[model samples]
Target: MTSTPGERERRTSERVIALLMLLIHTRHGYTTAQIRRHVEGYAELGDEAFEKAFQRDRALLEDIGVPLSLEQPEDADARHVVDASALLLPEIDFSGAERRALLHAREVWSETRLQTEVMRAVGLLVDPGSAGEADDGLGLPRVVQRLTPNLEVFLDAAVEQQVLAFGYRTAAGAVSPQDRPRRVRIWSALEIGGAWYAAGWDLDRQGERLFRVSRVIGRPEELPGTGSDAPARPADWNPVEIRDRLLGQGEGLRDRVRLWVAPGRGHSVRLRGQAVTPTAQDGAAPGEGWELWETDRPAHDGLVQLCGGLMGVVQPSAADPDVVAEVLAAWRRVAEVHDGAPPPHPELAKPRQSRYRQGQRERVSRLLDIVGLANRAGGITKVELADRLELSPKALDADLRDLQYCGLPERLFPGWLFDVDAESDVVEVRQAVDLPAPIRLSLPEAHRLSAALDTVAQMPHADDEVAPAAVTAAARIRQVLADVGHTGATTSVRPSTGGTDDPGDAAAVVPSAADGGGAGGHEPPATPVTSFWDVHADQDTVRVLMDAVARHRVVRLRYHALHSDRTTEREVEPVQLVQSGVVLYLQGHCRTAGAMRTFRVERISAVEPTGEIAKARRRPKKTMLTPVDTTLEAVLAWHHRIRDLADDYAPRLEAQDADGRRLTRLGLLSEDAAIALAGMHAGDVEVLEPAELRQAVRDRALAALRRLETAVRL
Candidate 1:
């Protein structure tokens, strides 16, 4: 079976290239006959051999992130064309400055075990030479290792919303006792402030708690699972915030306290807003060493240790009779809390896991959002879908594949999973077989879905049967929320803007509507709110406008123009609704203006769909927000002493001289912005800009220096 040296390798390479070229060159899909006739290697193979080869090649192409599709031929006589988008390797879009940043990153990453893999990936994605240039020869040791195995397992379970049974090791090295299972519905696996922590409702504790992945004694065993019991993550849960709260790691005052510290040495505390003054004490020396310090009682143990040298209880006074009683009362409460328990292992209390797994939540959330959107739209075009999701076509395809592979445990069958169909020019997705019946819902999603169903019932020509079913579904959702202890959950429904109607009446299904078909003699289905509008939006108006936009329909609006200072009614073909800051603006082609205009949602007092569908037109990609001017450029020269600041603040390296001085160009909007930036990073940044800006910064610095000198004299 041995061939000439490199013959086999060369053949595969040539075939791969030839196959790519064939796929790229063909606009219309090529059938098996066309592929055999056109592709170089396929022509030489026999029927069965070609079948195996074609399948392998197609699979290989897809494995490398190519968007390949298989579809039934339109004509039964024709073989299926392997429909695929042209495979173009993504161009490295790193700017010169970004490249330099990556080069610095490469230097940092090179010290790790990931060095080889990172370099290989970088070489494949971008040029290796560019990545290797300007190595900052400071060889720092790797501090972060690859994610621990337990962290990965926890992350996988969290994404699937599965319950895991595991033996967690306590700080005392005691593992979970046998016979009793510790089951938890993993809410999230997070790396906050560089450590990994997995949080969830501890089925055993009946309350939420976190665990350190590193302290997990053994592999977490997946419990026999059902979707119904998936616990809700806390409503106001932020991994970092939760971790900080749980660890009691913040600067806060517990009680008013005063201390006397070594004078001048207490500047650290004084700088933190503590009032400091020379103490009135019985001392022989005129210039005493001790100074009175009054501040909030330092909350953290570290802060307590820092204040240990100080004379304590100055405010309460050690002589106060109640101080002893207060101390005893505090001790009694502590004794009651920790009476007979070996304190929960320190690891259990403060999980010190790595943060590499933090983005898992975002990935799962995005996947669900995509699925939900696709289900509502029935199908969406690939380009539009990508734009809505803010992803590249290639990235979309990759994520789709990820989605296709994700689902409930029952998704072992192909039909159970979400399916993508891109046979035609437009790509469509078949929603997962097990949607509308998921294991659990994030609270916000449940509320949103409930509101959407209510909106759907209000639409003209909506079936009566839909209302009762929707009501039942909404009740079940509320029950689910209740089951998860979210008792006071309310529907975030907004009123209809077309008419002055009660918000409650808006949710009630109407018995009948005036039956009149529009120009096409077909009544459009009522619009439902799809996009989560800004918090300040008139939900009713936004719903109507978004509905019109989705159906390519026109809407009549009573809008008050800020410039005109007048309210006028006008018909607009709602193109899209965009959010900027706290305001939602409807960007549409105005019949009155005869051009595309963006109207603030608040100004639009009324909205009524005009029943007329708009002719398809290309939407403007540009938004109303003007791009910030980065015209004010500065060349910052930094001394070697300020190398760390230079690394942090510099946008691009302009030059580095023999004396270890670095010059960097910083693009800014105005002198004010530059001044603010330089002031924030004062001493580290030397601005050499439009002489005026430089002079202003210099003057500000001198003024500050003069103030300090004056204070010293006083």
Candidate 2:
């Protein structure tokens, strides 16, 4: 009888497992004829079918990192053998602090693309039952940084010392022609000011250069046989220094400028500067409750970024006569870009592909992990084993049956390589088949672990008494990978500490000067040092709030609400700190309002302990962490050029226009947020529906323009 597709796959899998077991367990390897005779499912196949199946299975095993090799005897056919020493990871015994650090890294990447890889890597070290129970992030501040596909490609290439070819966009937002792809050997890649960057040897230029990752036109391609020819990275290469030099920061003339800030606004800016009495020479007389503040900043471009980011709320003083004009010009440039027509074609569209193959790889990884886990436990209950592997009882039974077929040839040995006692309540592996330890980390897994640990290193520890566990753990893991010939780009990429200094700047959504202009020649205003992962809260405030959350204490907060432009003092029962997009929030029950509320951590100016234990309250549901309100919706239109930005809203594609612009429906939480989102992309995005929202965006831009005009007259 012909077998069904599922049955055929199962048979193939069992045959492969048996073949691997025989090769790994036997001292003198097995020849082709011996393998077919002993491995299950192989003897049932015809000569042609068996040859095809054996070749495919051998390739699969090698693809999954099984170091399979062939040995030739003096007077016999070649024998296939598995290289056990190269396949297993060296045993590592982690300390309490190191284990906690690993757990923290896992939590940080839980929602990212690296989640699966990171979880599997951590699983190799911690007990499956206890891994989920650790409160690793209890007293630590959290910062979520996004890793783009291009960034990951560059990271891998940096490790392998490969030369890359890709189209690059200038700071003015013009993409180089395809034929003129920039060739570079990346020495280092890193995150600075929330943007990803790579510093490398520009082959065409024959000198060191930095490329902002966001400006890369398309997926980079590796040049054939180029890594070996590239020069070694300089011993003293520093990514930070390269970034500062390229951006013209840290070595410029400084100027003291006064600003008129509106009340309850610019809280972050307030922290950086001091309040001053209003003076006639500063600008037009302050309106209503506006107050004057003074700050010393780098001249010209830096001043423009600071004032432009604070836009309407901040007016430059006469101390720097050209500062106001420069800021106004920058805004006009951005406005011009917004008012232009859409691009003829989309520039940065991401490829959407099925993840079926990825799922298959993960399953193979799990199977290998199970071997190590069962061997280490000696014997474990079937239910416990199923739970640990996240498989149903039926699925676990199938896996066990497959293992039963994997063993030495009957002529060579008496029993199977693995004695899986499925009939009993307990499942035990009597023979390990030389796979008692977990496999070495893959390149992607190593990069994810390194990046996650880098974020953990940047986080402020809640308790001063505790040592820096992340730093120590990172060093140990790096050494292990290095010893095994896996050199990942760990030292290159890292999280940035720079953030928007003005609280009002959160509302400012201008494009980076380094980004490309949409469809027109107009460029965006130079934005303040901001990251794609916008972290607004001060480190000290985060530390205090995290400590309070850990202790379950009631704290008083002086928060400035961006929607209402009001500053209010309230007592809140700290519950959990959550991150939504680039913004971090404190979810808790507010004693002052007598209700549950979510507060933006950045807008909070002061946090003081109320000297009272938090009252017993039900925790908010997981859905509450989402910032968007799905009930409200808006229609938006944008050229394919900004598909990356449009995808952020998880919009539904509505239709396509003749101009190659896409009409998409997006859910909105508030009108202000929608406006900010549109303004942030300049004119790349258009609000097609919700006439009120469209008007609101126009009104906001006009108001800012009027303010700029008035400042110019002063």
Cα lDDT listed for each candidate: 0.44, 0.60
- Per-residue lDDT tens digits for candidate 1, residues 425-525, read 35445644323211133443333333333322322211223324434444454565555554332232321111110111110001001111010122111
Per TM-score, the best of the predicted structures is 2
lDDT of 2 by residue, 84-187 (tens): 77777666676666666677666554234455567677766665455333344554533343445577677666665678998876543455679899888775
TM-score of each model, in listed order: 0.31, 0.75
Tell me the deviation in Å of residue 357 in model 2: 7.4
Weakest lDDT window of 10 consecutive positions for candidate 1: 503-512
Q: Candidate 2: global Cα-lDDT?
A: 0.60
